[model samples]
Target: MATLLHQITIDAPASRIWEMLTSRLGLQAWWDGTVSIAGGDCWRLSSDDLESPVTLKVVEEEPDKSLEWLCVQGDPDWENTLVLWTLEKAKRGFTIRLEHRDWRLSEIDLAAENTRWGERLMKLRLQCHHNDDLPVNDDDLSVWT
Candidate 1:
């Protein structure tokens, strides 16, 4: 399995970043998906790219420090995969470390997911720092529209 990692320091408090990581509204803003708390320790993330809702189980949550999730249901391609987000104090404010791991797929698929997540993180950074909701490009407007 392969892992993709991304790290960025945002100009925001850990509390704010944590909220954006854990809350439905915050996730929807950055992910450009239909996000809902399915129940305790579970969330449903739906997007046009997926044929069905993906149920993610909260694997770990460390307040303002870190959060991890395991994909429990939905697309076969994403099944059994993991996503982790870690936050740390930084000079600018806080640093976000993101990982999408356990890829049992083709290189092309993995690359696509990597790019998609990078774009999402950029939006997340913009939102936390400037409260901006504009898309980064015309083709990506669907994400913020």
Candidate 2:
């Protein structure tokens, strides 16, 4: 088992960041994919880079504090994994801590996954900053080809 952790400091309020993490519209703004509601606190995330849609079940949520999801479907390597986001108020903005855990080591390429997550988090940060020229589908890092 392995856990991927990353952190970023965004110049935004926790409420705004929380919306970006919890809302479908907000997600589509930053996420490099289409986001749709799967009903009952579940979301379906689909991207050209992904073989299939990932179904994420909201396991825990605390407004402006934290949000956690469990991957219930999609890639076998992703199933049963947890994606968590924790937000803390900072002197200038908010600090976001992300953890993607419970990965089966043998089934995944940790380096690739880490890079992907890092890119996604960077998009999240850019979105929170209201960057008009967001690379929603642009793979500047050339990692999602």
lDDT of 1 at 126: 83
lDDT of 2 at 119: 94
Give the poorly placed runs of model 1, Cα more than 4 Å off: 131-145
| Model number with the top lDDT | 2
Tens-digit per-residue lDDT, 1-145, candidate 2: 9999999999987767876887776788778989887775788888876678899999888788988999999977788999999999888899999999998855458877888889999999988988443334421221111
Worst 10 residues of 2 by lDDT: 136-145
Pairs clashing within candidate 2: none
What does candidate 1's lDDT look like per residue over 69-106, in tens digits?
99999988778889999998998899899998898978
| C-alpha TM-score for every candidate | 0.87, 0.86
How does residue 76 of candidate 2 score in lDDT? 74
Model 2 spans with C-alpha error above 4 angstroms:
106-108, 131-145
Q: Which window of ten consecutive residues has the lowest lDDT sum in model 1?
A: 136-145
